[model samples]
Target: MTITIPTGDLVGVLSDVVNFAHPKPDGGVLNCVRLNWDGEYLHATATDRIRAGISTWHKDDEPDDDGQDDLFSNWGGADNPWSILMPLDDAKDVISNYKLGPKEYRVPLTIDLHQGVLKIERSRDTGHSRLVMQIQGVLEEFPDVREILANNDRVKPVTGQLYTAKFLADFAKVRARGPLQLAFAEGLTHITIGKRFVGAIAPLPEDRAAA
Candidate 1:
């Protein structure tokens, strides 16, 4: 199982818009995840107040069993940056573990908060890809993400009930009139659906005067 992508690229894309909010009654953990950019791609998933998911990243090195002690301090690229934490699992239950570079795979990872980089020790086994990211030292201890996942209330039968309810209600409101046309442009995909404003919809061909 191998999936390799650019760390910097991944972080940059996800960072711009990764806002998953939890509004469950017993939803534990009031803290937000500040995904620490450590020159590695760490996939993560969480339900704002319902079901959950997980993802993995290609760190320079696989984190030790303890999963503490960041290697960023020793990495030293620049000053410092804000850290985003997401409740994610190691290659264990999250996404499939991936190869790193050509001619080598299956290496350990070390996270350095002080240096803002993930350390990897290359091995001569599988052909993996190498990715690099410019990260700064991540100050402040990252909140323990596992604590929320371990919560007993999380396993309740009514997980994501609120989300489900809202989605279903919204779905029913969709107009039977079919999909509405929005607009088109270069490097873009425009899709419109279920919006019911009399003026927002363009007139049908018969209603137009474009002789």
Candidate 2:
């Protein structure tokens, strides 16, 4: 199946994922972006075990007259979603190096996922390019990030102590355009931007919070 994502949206989601991805001292899959394309929407998530972020974008609608197979016709339901875990650096390079057309209003990227690899391709009247990136199969699953965000209600006041001030600041910077909410509960810091994106940061240890 071919999945097309706009350049602007692709860049935004990738930037957030890369920013939140944390390196592990033991060297593992924690430093990668988990991309799930469920036919209609593409979900990108990153987590450092301490903090996590999820970004989503919908696929472009096709015209009824276009006699092409529905990109999502074979999309197995959410229960069996197609996903690929890609290294943060490769994802960044693919987006940064994609060339946009001079007359194109929105640059669209086509991604082909097969055999644990993602082949990203972009074409314009001016030129075309393709990038193949290896995918780390679902070995170390990403934390239950959705459940973590869902449990933290945003309407309540934030009470948890700040753990990583720099992380909070960086996350705030990425979603700076919209109103950001910081909520704390059960030793976790929840950050929300508008209604689409949500993140969680683990609070500092009791000793550090007291200090």
Candidate 3:
């Protein structure tokens, strides 16, 4: 299947996902990014068993030749999303050095998945670039992160805690420019800049009173 998305949007999402990818010491799949398409929205997710990040982009409304509303009709059913595991380094290079031209209105980066390989292409009137990389063969499963996020109760009042200064700085570099919200719950702290970007990090352990 071929998926095309705006260069800026793709980069923003990828930058956030890469920050949260910490491989498990026991050799787990948390080191890679999971790309999923449910025939309507494209999602990128990464986790380290403790922290997680999820970024989603809805496909633009473009009618196909048959007057169909969805562009990914043949991709897969909503119940069964099409997914591929991309190594961290490869996923970073996919968007590295990507810059929109001055006259470019909306340059698109196209991802083509076929035969266990993923091809990424970007082109403009001035220049073009492409990268082909192999997807991870091991189907180490990813947890249903979205389900966990949705099930959290938002009615209870949440208390604010001091996040690591270093983490706060790092988050600012990738977070979308605007007001931000932080929520702490169930030993995890979630930071959200907008509806498009969400990231989770483990909260610091509570300090014990002096004896």
Candidate 4:
């Protein structure tokens, strides 16, 4: 089955989540960006256990005239969501190509998933060349990051707590559309970047934070 995502939206989602993805050698499944489609919104998420990043893209209508194959049917039912894990390198490549490629050549990317392999195609108008790339999807199951993302509670505010500076700084890489806000509490530090991206970073123990 195949689905189309807007060029700018793809780049935005990738940029927001890529930094949170861990390296393949160390993190295995955590080194991927999970792409989920629920018949409306397409979400991209990644985490390195300590911190996470998430972004969403909405599709109102199908872009291709042929209609292609139904993503839901290929998986199960419309109510059941479909997801695949893309490598961190592929996510970075997409972002880099979009930024460095000719502006006029930028077009919506078509994602084709089949038989354990995932393919992405970017086609240019008329005389321009098309770019197609394929890579294997990681078969390992991704951790339940939703559980971590939902535990953010700032009700009992705290101060002077220690957090890893590197984790806090990853939020800045999100390229948020609006102001980035951080809500500190006793446990996790909730991060909100614009309206579409959200994340959380675990606080470090004072002993470890000082090192």
Best by TM-score: 4
Compared with the true structure, what per-residue lDDT tens digits does model 1 show for residues 1-211?
1223332323322332122324332434422234443343443333333322222344343322223322322322322332434332321111223333322222322233333433322222222344222233233454343343433222222111112345223223322223544332221212233232111111223324333
Which lDDT tens digits does candidate 4 get at residues 1-211?
5777656667778888888888665778888999877766778999988888788776642222223333332221143456788888877887777543334322457776677677776766422468787877788889877776666564455646677677778788776467888787556777887777788887887677667
- TM-score of each predicted structure versus truth: 0.27, 0.75, 0.73, 0.79
- Summarize candidate 2's per-residue lDDT along 1-211 as a digit string, tens digits: 5666655556667766677887643436777788888767778898887888887766443312333333433322233357888776776675567634333324555677777767765554323454444444555666667886777645446445747778766686553435787777665777877655778888779788778
Q: For candidate 3, report its TM-score.
A: 0.73
Which segments of candidate 2 are over 4 A away from where they belong? 60-81, 99-105, 126-139, 151-160
lDDT by residue (tens digit), candidate 3, 1-211: 6777656556656777876676443536777888877767788888765567887776552211222223432322244346777777767776566645433324566666666666666644324555344444336777777777766525345555555666556567555644677776666677787667677666566672111
Give the lowest summed-lDDT range of ten residues in model 2.
61-70
Task: Give the lDDT of residue 66 in candidate 2.
Answer: 31
TM-score of 1: 0.27
Q: What lDDT score is found at residue 20 in candidate 3?
A: 69
Q: List the residue pairs that clash in candidate 4.
A: none
Please give the range of 10 consecutive residues that has the lowest summed lDDT in model 3: 61-70
- Score residue 34 of candidate 2 by CA lDDT: 85
lDDT of 2 at 51: 83
Of the candidates shown, which would achieve the greatest lDDT relative to the real structure?
A: 4
lDDT of 1 at 209: 31
For model 3 the local lDDT of residue 27 reads 39
Model 2: colliding residue pairs: none
Cα displacement (Å) at residue 204, model 3: 1.5
Computed on alpha carbons, the lDDT of every model, listed in order, comes to: 0.30, 0.64, 0.62, 0.70
